[model samples]
Target: MAIADQSGRTVFITGASAGVGRQTAIVLAAAGATVVLGCRDLAKGAAVRDHIRAVTPAARVSVVALDLASLESIREAAKQVCAEHDRIDVLINNAGVMRPPRSTTADGFELQFGTNHLGHFALTGLLLERLLPVAGSRVVTVASPAHRQGRIDFDDLQSERRYRRSAAYAQSKLANLLFTYELQRRLAVGGATTVALAAHPGGARTELNRNLPFLFRGASWGLARPITHPVEIGALSILYAAVDPGALGGEYYGPDGLFEFKGQPTRLESTPRSHDAATQRRLWEVSQQLTDVRYDALAKSR
Candidate 1:
């Protein structure tokens, strides 16, 4: 069932300037939740905030600058958030980059692996202490169906040796699932009320492809999948995971309709590798080592 009461709920979403995060913000605001839209560009973020305000009229909305490539920027964003809001009910790790070729982040990690997995990893870990005590707090993360083809090559997690764009992107997405599932397992063992759940948008059309070369962008924009699903539908799984009472912690969800690339929220199947306890644990350990942030320990400090 849907979450019926959200008058005072606060949702902090990364990449809120476009696609799933943007649409989810609008839907959540209408449901009476305060929405914080995190973006890398302050000006673009403001434009999204305006659109939200225009639609919800009196929508509790704010935009903050957040660049996932830099840890300093992530820390600064968290500080700004803590200073502005005492608590956040929901944290959506929705911002991600796909298939960028041969580039490293500010922290010297591969772009997709760094931005998609490590950035969100550090961000969530930084915010967990603040969220865990809130009782109903949930961290909703986004993964991808592309993860089905992923295998974590721990020896080359940064793709320093083999930098095929898709390989790196898929590996990072796989890391996201591993982190989400492991987070839930850890939280359960510790008896924390916080829940770690994930949702994937099956090729919903979003601006995530805007950075691609013109031909690819044009081809994607003209396609029937990402550009096919209405942004509203693209936001459904995220909205469902964020508020739906049935969305159990540690569970992975996706579009329930045909092939799981487009449809309503449902318990779509993940690859067997995603469910492998051994691999998941390995990913958790590697992620901890790479990001150098332990959310579990942080939760304990509180």
Candidate 2:
């Protein structure tokens, strides 16, 4: 429960309508941070705000419409955020979808890759200026252990050649880490004070797995009761990355327990492949080309 006090900070969280995003928003709001819930569902977002307010009567909370499945929504959300807030202390790319039937985003990219990776890539690029001006600002992107199973198929990045739901989802999560490390590298090279970090919930009990195979979903639900903790616990890794004074850019954190399935947030290591510089660079370039949103600070600094 003891975490950094973000008393006067501004935190913008994506997918705050429910799950870990919602839990993180509440925690930050309770700590007196101005919490902006970026959600695609206004009604669900309102309910989350009400919950936060009920917990902390003086909570500073607001909601902006955001749909990670659409590049247009990301732009509008970023604009609304910048128009309203002078600075952003932290931006949490916490919203995501799990293994779903193969689909494409509004931008016509693979659903998981578009929403989970490209959406955030564009959002962060568009909002980098707002973060750069604020000392110690951080951007935390959520990855998953499933990332270990991911392989970036540049030839078929959208799974147009072969589509396996689980593999696609894993690839997207891997993209998150690649994006985080690449962003951190750019931020440091650009002489920017802001940092980019990544975290994983370590198998938290959330609705992200609702799209799994029905049999697996039913069986996992029963087994997960003992292995998976609640959203709050899963959210600690994110809060730690967002506010932990010792947290470094490009570092990743997750649970510290058995197989990293459940435990308190702790510094965790990702797969060796996730740290490949060449792949990271390639992914960054492709992401820029796909999303069409470039990080200006890096270019200006270069």
Candidate 3:
């Protein structure tokens, strides 16, 4: 059932302390990939490394602190990773915050959009050079079924207006899909082997939902109980996108069961809006302006 061993691969996964990212890291390590765990908290990252070692004594796991709320921290982390490794075979943008009390990132961007989208956007651009030079690197962004109901408000990408917590989150996740799609387009034009793809967990029980207010937490749990799959199972779709054979340049995947909230990894349709190349390109430009991270820099030499 697992894909063939990825013995020589190096994987960088964010939010590796717990939940889907943690489980996905462990699974990748078990598949013989050397995994770099990116965490907002160093101690938590170390604990994950130790736990992986306990279970798979020979697991190659390293921890690095990456605070998605701070662009400087993300830059430093990406720089350090590039300095240490010759190439990263896969980059999983799995770390993200959900519905935190209305707040802003270090750069003053709204938390959900900043941490979930812009942070990863900047990091990806920073590391694009390293990944593209490698033979077949892939970037996998974890999105959500909630994106189905999202509309990117160009007027207020940060939700500076009409900020409902849920809406902000939807916008951020929608941004994730847009970023993934645009990256794939650029990778193709640049003639790079590195691929960019998107996948969503479809409401598996992960800590991503932990930020919800207590009442909403209980309510969500009750509402999705029977249909919600285990976090570990939820990780399969991401892992599949990360290492499965014949992975495409721009594809979206989710659970193969009811409402895509449960069961095995399988192809799932993205909302028609998510497929709009023009909107994706516009969002890409806005992201560059906001984060001051540019993918075109990767194009300059090529």
Candidate 4:
């Protein structure tokens, strides 16, 4: 897929030190977009920025410190980004944790839910002012097919009652979809030019699985190796959603191959549960309250 020249566009991608995020950053930068990498480790992000500059000497790439596991870090990162950049053409909420052992964020929320969903939620809300004023700006979130098995256990959102790594991960991914759809609706109602969309890498061979147990990691690397694609391919869906002229708000993108495992990027349908407006609205309110970062500009439409 040929990407259009992104001269003058500015794209911010989280978790960009490695995996699909890193690939997306490099590709966009090469395409002439000013790419800002949001990485937990400043050193790793600087290395990636240096690498991009080395290969594509004209590529505009910079690094920002972002630790999604901590709300304070998220706030500081957003502030730093807003202070430096006047507008954001694209904000890719691509950073996330996979099926890690049960843990909690600094705010005490489940690790997967906090870092994957809530962290992006807060960041996006905080940066709405920057995005709202930009024409054709987009908030593209990265989700997973595991959302199919998810059920938002509102009763135990933090997984305090019980903890299953896979189940928790599924819920977080589902939240990602719900957030995307809801954000799109709000952006439209608020009459903002910014739009929200989502994409999934399908079975991409990324470091996201590093947190999984040894047996599962072995199965993923050995048994599931044939099904997964490289990070470059994995980032295609994200790129399509972020820059495709035909892509629309609220739309979902993923691989086109069998079970969406690997292939070209294409429009895809999310599960019906992901489209439930009621749940989406509920989740939005809850997220705002939990994160204490309100999208007042967007809420004006409500």
Candidate 5:
């Protein structure tokens, strides 16, 4: 059976130009949702939009330029989205950078931390008003298994003292889960019906591996069946998070296959560190400071 037709619903997805983000957009668009494709590259975004229209002639898809690395870009994108639509039923924080080399964002935060976590954090904060009035809305963040190996080094958040690509990526993924849970708690406290949840692609084959070492990349591809699944299968978890009526606030979904790498979407548990209340609160504060965005509606609801 197909997921229910999402006619009249609007979903905004970051990084929709490629990979699981792109696949998820296609699925929702085919189901009759108005899919807003958020991409750093507008040309690529347009191509994806055109492709969706071609496949699903009735699909409503729009391409918006979004660069998560820059707070200014995020603000501009949010403004445009809010102006174009009255309500956003779902916001998928799917754009992310994996184990890339040490790099800084336009705002000087580490690339993975800035793009993967802070970017979505700010975007959601900016769009909270549009979401709050809508009933049963959701914010679904995409995290990773790498979070299991992550440690939130509060003192060296930027990895200014010591930089390891994998460690920094893991930390950012962990931050994603922490953000999801913390946001859900705040939403509940504020009495808002806008729920927050998370999902992971679970080792799906996507262009996100462009940053991996050549040998490691080769190994991942060569061992594809044993390690990775197609992006479509991977995107199922995100679809579940976005549209599952039974899904609850603060819950997480990922693959149920071996090592949670490849299988149907299923409820999954995150690391103990991801569930730490103090860390989630602290990270929320730091993210606000770095992004200069605040969830003012949440405060008003309290």
Candidate 6:
């Protein structure tokens, strides 16, 4: 798919300090979009902004402080963003945490689930008003193949019973897909122009694995080397969902190679588990209650 020129568009991307999000921000900014980098570290985000500006002198880039683990931080960042931008053309829920030592967010939810799923959920809901009024606006979330291994154990959504790093990560990724599909349904029902979509990078060489145990990280890297692609390539699936005019709501994109590990981005299928309407609705309700940010505009038809 040919990427549409984003001239005059405003794009807000989380985790823009590094990896897929960083590359996505650069590409869109280079294409003439006013890109906002939502980073936990302002210094890192400013550095990325400077780097992009140095290369594309005409690029309009801004850095906003964002920490997905803390609802306070998320709300402040969203408020700052909405106060500054009248319309957001694309909001990429691209930030995520991989397998880390068991921990909790400020809200006491599991780290991976809170930061990766709830954080984006709240941010998207807060920013929906900005997106809904804009024609062709999109919410492109980054999920993963790890979702196939995930099962949302509502009995212990926070891993209070058992906390396996891989399981937590998988659950979070699955939640991403669920949120995308549910949000799309609500948007369509409300007759909104903003759409929701998802994408995955497959095996990308990024710092997301830095939190894994040393031996496991080294072994996995060695074994996965043949399947892993560069960060630029990883960002393609996300960019496709963000800019491709043909991409539609409730769609997913990933690599075209074997096992979807590498190569060009293309439309892909997710597990049937990710498509459960009942689970999606339940998760959405839980997310709203947890985040305290309501998608009232999209909820009228629900």
Q: Per-residue CA lDDT of candidate 3, range 175-289, in tens?
A: 8998899889888887788899998776678667777666436534655578887888889889889988866879998898988888888877788888899999999999899
The Cα error of candidate 5 at residue 108, in Å, is: 0.5
Of candidates 2 and 1, the better by TM-score: 2
Question: Per-residue alpha-carbon lDDT of model 5 for 185-226, expressed as tens digits?
Answer: 999988899999999999888888877767546425554557
Pairs of residues clashing in candidate 2: none
Candidate ordering by TM-score (highest first): 5, 4, 2, 6, 3, 1
lDDT of 6 by residue, 166-229 (tens): 9999999999999999999988888888899999987888888787666435424655778888
Evaluate model 2: give its TM-score. 0.96
Models 1 onward score TM values of 0.93, 0.96, 0.96, 0.97, 0.97, 0.96
Q: 1-302, model 2: which lDDT tens digit per residue?
A: 58667788999999999889998998999888999999999999999999999999999999999999999999999999999998999999999988888889999999999999999999999888788889999999999989999999999999999999999999999999999998999888888888999998887877787886564354245546677887889899999998889888989999998888889888888999999999999999999999899887557655
* Deviation (Å) of 255 in candidate 5: 0.3
Q: CA lDDT of each candidate? A: 0.85, 0.90, 0.87, 0.92, 0.92, 0.92
lDDT of 4 by residue, 181-214 (tens): 9999888887877999999998888778786666
| Candidate 1: Cα lDDT at 123 | 92
Residue 100 of model 4 has an lDDT of 83
Worst lDDT run of 10 residues, candidate 6, spans: 214-223
Clashes of each: 3, 0, 0, 0, 0, 0
